[model samples]
Target chain A: DQQVKQNSPSLSVQEGRISILNCDYTNSMFDYFLWYKKYPAEGPTFLISISSIKDKNEDGRFTVFLNKSAKHLSLHIVPSQPGDSAVYFCAALPRKTGNQFYFGTGTSLTVIP
Target chain B: DAGITQSPRHKVTETGTPVTLRCHQTENHRYMYWYRQDPGHGLRLIHYSYGVKDTDKGEVSDGYSVSRSKTEDFLLTLESATSSQTSVYFCAISESTTGNTIYFGEGSWLTVV
Candidate 1:
Protein backbone atom coordinates (compact mmCIF):
# COMPACT_ATOMS: atom_id res chain seq x y z
CA ASP A 1 0.00 0.00 0.00
CA GLN A 2 2.95 2.31 -0.26
CA GLN A 3 2.01 4.58 -3.10
CA VAL A 4 5.54 5.83 -3.41
CA LYS A 5 8.60 3.64 -3.20
CA GLN A 6 12.34 4.18 -3.06
CA ASN A 7 13.68 0.69 -3.53
CA SER A 8 17.24 1.50 -2.66
CA PRO A 9 17.71 1.96 1.03
CA SER A 10 21.27 3.34 0.71
CA LEU A 11 23.86 4.38 -1.81
CA SER A 12 27.53 5.40 -1.76
CA VAL A 13 29.47 7.47 -4.20
CA GLN A 14 32.79 9.32 -4.43
CA GLU A 15 32.97 13.06 -4.00
CA GLY A 16 32.79 15.13 -7.17
CA ARG A 17 30.91 12.30 -8.89
CA ILE A 18 27.37 12.23 -10.13
CA SER A 19 24.92 10.91 -7.57
CA ILE A 20 21.56 9.72 -8.72
CA LEU A 21 18.56 8.79 -6.59
CA ASN A 22 15.49 7.09 -7.96
CA CYS A 23 11.85 6.85 -6.90
CA ASP A 24 8.70 5.27 -8.23
CA TYR A 25 5.05 5.81 -7.50
CA THR A 26 2.06 3.59 -7.97
CA ASN A 27 -0.50 6.34 -7.96
CA SER A 28 -1.17 7.95 -11.30
CA MET A 29 -3.13 10.71 -9.66
CA PHE A 30 0.03 12.21 -8.27
CA ASP A 31 0.73 15.30 -10.30
CA TYR A 32 3.57 16.89 -8.36
CA PHE A 33 6.81 15.39 -7.11
CA LEU A 34 9.31 16.81 -4.65
CA TRP A 35 12.59 15.92 -3.05
CA TYR A 36 13.63 16.59 0.54
CA LYS A 37 16.93 16.21 2.35
CA LYS A 38 17.36 15.41 6.03
CA TYR A 39 20.36 15.28 8.29
CA PRO A 40 20.83 13.11 11.35
CA ALA A 41 18.87 15.15 13.89
CA GLU A 42 17.19 17.84 11.83
CA GLY A 43 13.90 17.82 10.02
CA PRO A 44 13.66 17.47 6.26
CA THR A 45 14.23 20.48 4.00
CA PHE A 46 12.88 21.04 0.53
CA LEU A 47 15.31 20.39 -2.28
CA ILE A 48 13.63 20.49 -5.66
CA SER A 49 10.31 19.66 -7.32
CA ILE A 50 8.85 18.88 -10.70
CA SER A 51 5.37 19.00 -12.09
CA SER A 52 3.82 16.31 -14.22
CA ILE A 53 3.63 18.65 -17.17
CA LYS A 54 7.41 19.00 -17.26
CA ASP A 55 9.88 16.26 -17.95
CA LYS A 56 12.84 17.86 -16.23
CA ASN A 57 13.65 20.63 -13.80
CA GLU A 58 17.03 21.84 -12.69
CA ASP A 59 18.21 24.08 -9.89
CA GLY A 60 21.88 24.80 -9.46
CA ARG A 61 23.45 21.37 -8.92
CA PHE A 62 20.22 19.50 -8.41
CA THR A 63 18.18 18.12 -11.31
CA VAL A 64 14.92 16.18 -11.24
CA PHE A 65 13.60 14.16 -14.13
CA LEU A 66 10.07 12.89 -14.37
CA ASN A 67 8.67 10.17 -16.61
CA LYS A 68 4.94 9.97 -16.40
CA SER A 69 4.76 6.77 -18.38
CA ALA A 70 6.89 4.89 -15.90
CA LYS A 71 5.66 6.68 -12.85
CA HIS A 72 9.29 7.31 -11.95
CA LEU A 73 11.42 10.29 -11.06
CA SER A 74 15.06 10.83 -10.20
CA LEU A 75 17.28 13.39 -8.53
CA HIS A 76 20.75 13.98 -9.86
CA ILE A 77 23.50 15.99 -8.20
CA VAL A 78 26.70 16.71 -10.06
CA PRO A 79 29.98 17.05 -8.24
CA SER A 80 28.44 15.65 -5.13
CA GLN A 81 30.01 17.11 -2.03
CA PRO A 82 30.48 15.77 1.45
CA GLY A 83 27.84 18.13 2.69
CA ASP A 84 25.37 16.44 0.38
CA SER A 85 25.48 13.24 2.38
CA ALA A 86 22.07 12.77 3.91
CA VAL A 87 18.82 10.90 3.68
CA TYR A 88 16.85 11.94 0.61
CA PHE A 89 13.11 11.42 0.43
CA CYS A 90 10.87 11.55 -2.61
CA ALA A 91 7.31 12.72 -2.06
CA ALA A 92 4.28 13.14 -4.23
CA LEU A 93 1.25 15.42 -4.07
CA PRO A 94 -1.80 13.60 -5.29
CA ARG A 95 -4.45 15.61 -6.99
CA LYS A 96 -7.48 16.23 -4.73
CA THR A 97 -5.60 14.87 -1.72
CA GLY A 98 -5.63 18.32 -0.12
CA ASN A 99 -1.84 18.60 -0.22
CA GLN A 100 -1.35 15.67 2.07
CA PHE A 101 1.84 14.33 0.50
CA TYR A 102 2.85 10.70 0.17
CA PHE A 103 6.52 10.08 0.95
CA GLY A 104 8.85 7.22 0.18
CA THR A 105 10.88 5.33 2.75
CA GLY A 106 13.91 7.46 1.81
CA THR A 107 17.37 6.67 0.50
CA SER A 108 20.49 7.38 2.51
CA LEU A 109 23.27 8.79 0.34
CA THR A 110 26.88 8.76 1.44
CA VAL A 111 29.50 10.78 -0.38
CA ILE A 112 33.07 9.77 0.29
CA PRO A 113 35.75 12.39 0.09
CA ASP B 1 13.43 28.19 9.59
CA ALA B 2 9.66 28.65 9.14
CA GLY B 3 9.37 29.62 12.82
CA ILE B 4 8.13 26.15 13.72
CA THR B 5 9.09 24.50 17.01
CA GLN B 6 8.25 21.04 18.40
CA SER B 7 8.45 20.88 22.17
CA PRO B 8 9.83 18.08 24.33
CA ARG B 9 12.41 17.00 21.74
CA HIS B 10 12.71 13.68 23.50
CA LYS B 11 10.43 11.84 25.91
CA VAL B 12 9.84 8.39 27.37
CA THR B 13 6.47 7.14 28.51
CA GLU B 14 5.00 3.91 29.76
CA THR B 15 2.41 1.92 27.86
CA GLY B 16 -1.26 2.91 28.31
CA THR B 17 -0.33 6.42 29.46
CA PRO B 18 -1.44 9.44 27.56
CA VAL B 19 1.08 11.71 25.85
CA THR B 20 0.76 15.02 24.16
CA LEU B 21 3.25 16.78 21.88
CA ARG B 22 3.12 20.46 21.11
CA CYS B 23 3.91 22.27 17.87
CA HIS B 24 4.12 26.04 17.83
CA GLN B 25 4.58 28.20 14.80
CA THR B 26 5.16 31.94 14.68
CA GLU B 27 4.62 32.34 10.95
CA ASN B 28 0.86 31.92 11.28
CA HIS B 29 0.70 29.58 8.27
CA ARG B 30 -2.79 28.47 7.31
CA TYR B 31 -1.86 24.79 7.22
CA MET B 32 -0.27 22.63 9.93
CA TYR B 33 0.51 18.91 9.99
CA TRP B 34 1.74 16.18 12.29
CA TYR B 35 3.76 13.27 10.89
CA ARG B 36 5.70 10.35 12.30
CA GLN B 37 8.87 8.82 10.85
CA ASP B 38 9.64 5.21 11.40
CA PRO B 39 12.45 2.90 10.28
CA GLY B 40 10.67 1.35 7.33
CA HIS B 41 8.26 4.21 6.83
CA GLY B 42 9.21 7.68 5.76
CA LEU B 43 6.94 10.43 7.03
CA ARG B 44 3.40 9.23 7.64
CA LEU B 45 0.87 11.93 8.22
CA ILE B 46 -1.11 11.62 11.44
CA HIS B 47 -3.34 14.64 11.09
CA TYR B 48 -3.47 18.14 9.68
CA SER B 49 -5.41 21.35 10.09
CA TYR B 50 -6.25 24.08 7.64
CA GLY B 51 -7.52 26.50 10.28
CA VAL B 52 -8.22 26.74 13.94
CA LYS B 53 -10.65 23.91 14.90
CA ASP B 54 -10.65 22.66 11.30
CA THR B 55 -8.66 19.49 11.48
CA ASP B 56 -8.66 16.32 9.35
CA LYS B 57 -7.12 12.89 9.56
CA GLY B 58 -4.24 11.80 7.40
CA GLU B 59 -3.02 8.44 6.14
CA VAL B 60 -2.15 7.12 9.57
CA SER B 61 -4.44 8.75 12.09
CA ASP B 62 -5.62 5.81 14.16
CA GLY B 63 -4.83 5.95 17.87
CA TYR B 64 -4.02 9.64 17.50
CA SER B 65 -5.97 12.85 17.80
CA VAL B 66 -5.13 16.46 17.05
CA SER B 67 -6.43 19.81 18.26
CA ARG B 68 -5.86 23.29 16.94
CA SER B 69 -7.53 25.79 19.22
CA LYS B 70 -5.21 28.57 18.09
CA THR B 71 -3.62 29.40 14.77
CA GLU B 72 -0.13 29.35 16.23
CA ASP B 73 -0.34 26.04 18.02
CA PHE B 74 -1.31 22.45 17.09
CA LEU B 75 -1.36 19.64 19.59
CA LEU B 76 -1.12 15.89 18.88
CA THR B 77 -2.30 13.51 21.52
CA LEU B 78 -1.76 9.78 21.89
CA GLU B 79 -4.60 8.64 24.08
CA SER B 80 -2.95 5.36 25.04
CA ALA B 81 0.71 4.99 24.24
CA THR B 82 1.95 1.72 22.87
CA SER B 83 5.41 0.34 22.23
CA SER B 84 4.76 0.34 18.53
CA GLN B 85 3.93 4.03 18.69
CA THR B 86 7.52 4.94 19.59
CA SER B 87 8.78 7.11 16.78
CA VAL B 88 9.99 10.57 15.86
CA TYR B 89 7.28 13.11 15.29
CA PHE B 90 7.55 16.11 12.98
CA CYS B 91 5.38 19.17 12.55
CA ALA B 92 5.09 20.98 9.24
CA ILE B 93 3.54 24.25 8.10
CA SER B 94 2.42 25.61 4.77
CA GLU B 95 0.60 28.67 3.58
CA SER B 96 -1.60 26.92 1.07
CA THR B 97 -2.95 23.46 0.42
CA THR B 98 -1.49 22.96 -3.04
CA GLY B 99 1.59 24.13 -4.92
CA ASN B 100 3.05 25.52 -1.70
CA THR B 101 6.28 24.63 0.03
CA ILE B 102 6.07 23.09 3.50
CA TYR B 103 8.58 23.61 6.30
CA PHE B 104 9.31 21.18 9.09
CA GLY B 105 10.39 21.56 12.69
CA GLU B 106 13.15 19.61 14.35
CA GLY B 107 11.41 16.37 15.27
CA SER B 108 10.36 15.13 18.69
CA TRP B 109 11.46 11.62 19.61
CA LEU B 110 9.03 9.62 21.70
CA THR B 111 9.88 6.29 23.24
CA VAL B 112 7.07 4.16 24.63
CA VAL B 113 7.90 1.28 26.93
Candidate 2:
Protein backbone atom coordinates (compact mmCIF):
# COMPACT_ATOMS: atom_id res chain seq x y z
CA ASP A 1 0.00 0.00 0.00
CA GLN A 2 1.12 3.58 -0.63
CA GLN A 3 1.46 5.12 2.78
CA VAL A 4 2.34 8.51 1.33
CA LYS A 5 0.37 9.92 -1.59
CA GLN A 6 0.58 12.94 -3.86
CA ASN A 7 -2.81 13.39 -5.47
CA SER A 8 -1.77 15.87 -8.13
CA PRO A 9 0.17 14.40 -11.02
CA SER A 10 1.48 17.75 -12.20
CA LEU A 11 1.17 21.51 -11.82
CA SER A 12 1.92 24.43 -14.16
CA VAL A 13 2.52 28.01 -13.13
CA GLN A 14 4.16 31.13 -14.50
CA GLU A 15 7.39 32.51 -13.20
CA GLY A 16 7.08 34.89 -10.26
CA ARG A 17 3.93 33.07 -9.18
CA ILE A 18 3.54 30.89 -6.16
CA SER A 19 3.85 27.11 -6.67
CA ILE A 20 2.15 24.82 -4.24
CA LEU A 21 2.74 21.04 -4.01
CA ASN A 22 0.75 18.86 -1.69
CA CYS A 23 1.25 15.44 -0.06
CA ASP A 24 -0.68 13.18 2.29
CA TYR A 25 0.25 10.31 4.54
CA THR A 26 -1.70 7.64 6.41
CA ASN A 27 0.86 6.41 8.93
CA SER A 28 0.43 7.98 12.34
CA MET A 29 3.91 7.06 13.45
CA PHE A 30 5.58 9.25 10.85
CA ASP A 31 6.96 12.30 12.63
CA TYR A 32 9.49 13.75 10.20
CA PHE A 33 8.63 14.86 6.68
CA LEU A 34 11.03 15.86 3.91
CA TRP A 35 10.79 17.27 0.42
CA TYR A 36 13.11 16.77 -2.52
CA LYS A 37 13.48 18.37 -5.94
CA LYS A 38 14.47 16.27 -8.95
CA TYR A 39 15.47 17.03 -12.53
CA PRO A 40 15.83 14.76 -15.52
CA ALA A 41 18.88 12.52 -15.36
CA GLU A 42 19.88 13.84 -11.93
CA GLY A 43 19.43 12.65 -8.40
CA PRO A 44 16.94 14.36 -6.16
CA THR A 45 18.21 17.20 -3.96
CA PHE A 46 16.93 17.86 -0.48
CA LEU A 47 14.86 20.97 -0.25
CA ILE A 48 13.27 21.51 3.14
CA SER A 49 11.74 19.47 5.91
CA ILE A 50 9.43 19.91 8.87
CA SER A 51 9.24 18.27 12.22
CA SER A 52 5.75 17.08 13.10
CA ILE A 53 6.06 19.01 16.31
CA LYS A 54 5.63 22.26 14.32
CA ASP A 55 3.01 23.29 11.82
CA LYS A 56 5.24 25.12 9.38
CA ASN A 57 8.86 25.52 8.34
CA GLU A 58 10.24 28.16 6.02
CA ASP A 59 13.56 28.71 4.29
CA GLY A 60 13.82 31.86 2.28
CA ARG A 61 11.43 31.44 -0.68
CA PHE A 62 10.34 27.89 0.17
CA THR A 63 7.92 26.97 2.92
CA VAL A 64 6.48 23.70 4.15
CA PHE A 65 3.23 23.42 6.07
CA LEU A 66 2.25 20.31 7.97
CA ASN A 67 -1.16 19.63 9.41
CA LYS A 68 -1.00 16.65 11.68
CA SER A 69 -4.72 16.65 12.18
CA ALA A 70 -5.31 16.34 8.45
CA LYS A 71 -2.37 14.04 7.74
CA HIS A 72 -1.35 16.39 4.95
CA LEU A 73 1.60 18.62 4.06
CA SER A 74 2.39 21.15 1.38
CA LEU A 75 5.41 22.89 -0.13
CA HIS A 76 5.06 26.44 -1.28
CA ILE A 77 7.60 28.15 -3.53
CA VAL A 78 6.90 31.86 -3.68
CA PRO A 79 7.75 33.79 -6.82
CA SER A 80 8.55 30.59 -8.63
CA GLN A 81 11.40 30.66 -11.14
CA PRO A 82 12.08 28.66 -14.27
CA GLY A 83 14.79 26.75 -12.47
CA ASP A 84 12.20 25.74 -9.92
CA SER A 85 10.50 23.54 -12.49
CA ALA A 86 11.07 19.94 -11.50
CA VAL A 87 9.44 16.90 -9.94
CA TYR A 88 8.95 17.35 -6.22
CA PHE A 89 8.68 14.40 -3.86
CA CYS A 90 7.57 14.26 -0.25
CA ALA A 91 8.94 11.56 2.05
CA ALA A 92 7.89 10.60 5.56
CA LEU A 93 9.78 8.68 8.22
CA PRO A 94 8.45 7.27 11.46
CA ARG A 95 9.76 8.29 14.84
CA LYS A 96 10.92 4.81 15.84
CA THR A 97 12.53 3.53 12.63
CA GLY A 98 16.23 4.02 12.07
CA ASN A 99 15.57 6.60 9.34
CA GLN A 100 13.68 4.33 6.96
CA PHE A 101 11.35 6.43 4.82
CA TYR A 102 8.25 6.17 2.65
CA PHE A 103 7.77 8.34 -0.44
CA GLY A 104 4.85 9.82 -2.29
CA THR A 105 4.12 9.52 -5.98
CA GLY A 106 5.59 13.01 -6.68
CA THR A 107 4.24 16.10 -8.42
CA SER A 108 5.85 17.61 -11.50
CA LEU A 109 5.80 21.38 -11.26
CA THR A 110 6.39 23.31 -14.49
CA VAL A 111 7.26 26.95 -13.93
CA ILE A 112 6.79 28.69 -17.23
CA PRO A 113 8.65 31.83 -18.13
CA ASP B 1 25.65 12.20 -5.35
CA ALA B 2 25.95 10.55 -1.96
CA GLY B 3 29.37 9.21 -2.91
CA ILE B 4 27.42 6.54 -4.79
CA THR B 5 28.03 5.24 -8.29
CA GLN B 6 25.73 3.00 -10.35
CA SER B 7 27.34 1.09 -13.19
CA PRO B 8 25.96 1.01 -16.75
CA ARG B 9 24.01 4.21 -16.30
CA HIS B 10 21.70 3.02 -19.07
CA LYS B 11 20.86 -0.47 -20.28
CA VAL B 12 18.40 -2.08 -22.64
CA THR B 13 17.62 -5.74 -22.25
CA GLU B 14 15.12 -8.29 -23.53
CA THR B 15 12.39 -10.03 -21.62
CA GLY B 16 13.45 -13.27 -19.92
CA THR B 17 17.05 -12.07 -19.73
CA PRO B 18 18.88 -11.64 -16.48
CA VAL B 19 20.17 -8.21 -15.53
CA THR B 20 22.23 -6.87 -12.71
CA LEU B 21 22.71 -3.33 -11.47
CA ARG B 22 25.65 -2.49 -9.33
CA CYS B 23 25.75 0.31 -6.75
CA HIS B 24 29.02 1.29 -5.16
CA GLN B 25 29.55 3.83 -2.43
CA THR B 26 32.83 5.43 -1.45
CA GLU B 27 31.65 6.69 1.92
CA ASN B 28 31.08 3.23 3.42
CA HIS B 29 27.67 4.21 4.69
CA ARG B 30 25.89 1.55 6.73
CA TYR B 31 22.60 1.80 4.88
CA MET B 32 22.08 1.12 1.15
CA TYR B 33 18.84 1.15 -0.77
CA TRP B 34 17.46 0.37 -4.24
CA TYR B 35 14.43 2.10 -5.68
CA ARG B 36 12.68 2.27 -9.03
CA GLN B 37 10.95 5.36 -10.42
CA ASP B 38 8.06 5.35 -12.85
CA PRO B 39 5.54 7.80 -14.22
CA GLY B 40 2.91 7.39 -11.53
CA HIS B 41 4.82 5.52 -8.82
CA GLY B 42 7.51 8.08 -8.00
CA LEU B 43 10.11 6.07 -6.11
CA ARG B 44 9.34 2.65 -4.67
CA LEU B 45 11.81 0.94 -2.44
CA ILE B 46 12.73 -2.54 -3.69
CA HIS B 47 15.24 -3.53 -1.06
CA TYR B 48 17.56 -2.11 1.55
CA SER B 49 20.64 -3.27 3.40
CA TYR B 50 21.46 -2.12 6.88
CA GLY B 51 24.88 -3.72 6.89
CA VAL B 52 26.93 -6.21 4.95
CA LYS B 53 24.84 -9.41 4.61
CA ASP B 54 21.91 -7.87 6.44
CA THR B 55 19.05 -6.94 4.13
CA ASP B 56 15.30 -6.64 3.93
CA LYS B 57 12.69 -6.42 1.23
CA GLY B 58 10.50 -3.42 0.63
CA GLU B 59 7.14 -2.84 -1.03
CA VAL B 60 8.11 -3.87 -4.57
CA SER B 61 10.53 -6.69 -4.00
CA ASP B 62 8.62 -9.45 -5.79
CA GLY B 63 10.80 -10.10 -8.84
CA TYR B 64 14.05 -8.68 -7.54
CA SER B 65 16.86 -9.85 -5.31
CA VAL B 66 19.67 -7.89 -3.68
CA SER B 67 23.01 -8.63 -2.10
CA ARG B 68 25.54 -6.68 -0.13
CA SER B 69 28.82 -8.50 0.13
CA LYS B 70 30.86 -5.47 1.15
CA THR B 71 30.02 -2.39 3.12
CA GLU B 72 30.35 -0.16 0.06
CA ASP B 73 28.64 -2.20 -2.65
CA PHE B 74 25.07 -3.32 -3.13
CA LEU B 75 23.93 -5.35 -6.09
CA LEU B 76 20.39 -5.70 -7.40
CA THR B 77 19.58 -8.58 -9.69
CA LEU B 78 16.54 -9.27 -11.77
CA GLU B 79 16.19 -13.03 -11.94
CA SER B 80 14.24 -12.68 -15.17
CA ALA B 81 13.67 -9.35 -16.79
CA THR B 82 10.24 -8.30 -17.91
CA SER B 83 8.89 -5.36 -19.87
CA SER B 84 7.12 -4.06 -16.79
CA GLN B 85 10.51 -3.72 -15.10
CA THR B 86 11.60 -0.93 -17.41
CA SER B 87 12.23 2.15 -15.30
CA VAL B 88 14.86 4.34 -13.70
CA TYR B 89 16.65 2.76 -10.77
CA PHE B 90 18.28 4.74 -8.01
CA CYS B 91 20.73 3.74 -5.33
CA ALA B 92 20.86 5.62 -2.08
CA ILE B 93 23.11 5.61 0.96
CA SER B 94 22.36 6.82 4.45
CA GLU B 95 24.57 7.45 7.43
CA SER B 96 23.65 6.02 10.81
CA THR B 97 21.75 8.57 12.81
CA THR B 98 18.70 8.88 14.91
CA GLY B 99 17.37 10.90 11.98
CA ASN B 100 19.62 10.22 9.03
CA THR B 101 19.28 11.95 5.69
CA ILE B 102 19.43 9.65 2.66
CA TYR B 103 21.30 10.63 -0.51
CA PHE B 104 20.81 9.16 -4.00
CA GLY B 105 22.86 8.44 -7.06
CA GLU B 106 22.30 9.67 -10.63
CA GLY B 107 20.15 6.58 -11.35
CA SER B 108 20.31 3.77 -13.88
CA TRP B 109 17.78 3.60 -16.66
CA LEU B 110 16.81 0.08 -17.71
CA THR B 111 14.56 -0.96 -20.56
CA VAL B 112 13.31 -4.44 -21.32
CA VAL B 113 11.81 -5.03 -24.71
Give the CAPRI class of candidate 1.
Answer: medium
lDDT of 2 by residue, A43-82 (tens): 8888999989899999999999999999999999998999
The top-ranked prediction according to lDDT is: 1
For candidate 1, lDDT tens digit of each residue in B34-111?
A: 999998899899999999999999989999999999999999999999998999999999887666778899999999
What is every candidate's C-alpha DockQ against the true complex, given to 2 decimals? 0.78, 0.64
Candidate 1's DockQ: 0.78
Per-residue lDDT of candidate 2, residues B14-108 (tens digit): 99999999999999899999999999899999999999999999889999999999999999999999999999999998887445678999999
RMSD of 1: 0.9
Can you write out model 1's per-residue Cα lDDT over A1-113, one digit (the tens) per residue? 89999999999999999999999999999998999999999999999999898999999999999999999999999989999999999999877768788899999999999
**Residue A18's C-alpha lDDT in candidate 2?**
97
Q: Using TM-score, give the best candidate's number.
A: 1
Would you estimate the TM-scores of all the predictions? 0.97, 0.96
- Worst 10-residue lDDT window for candidate 2 chain B reads B93-102
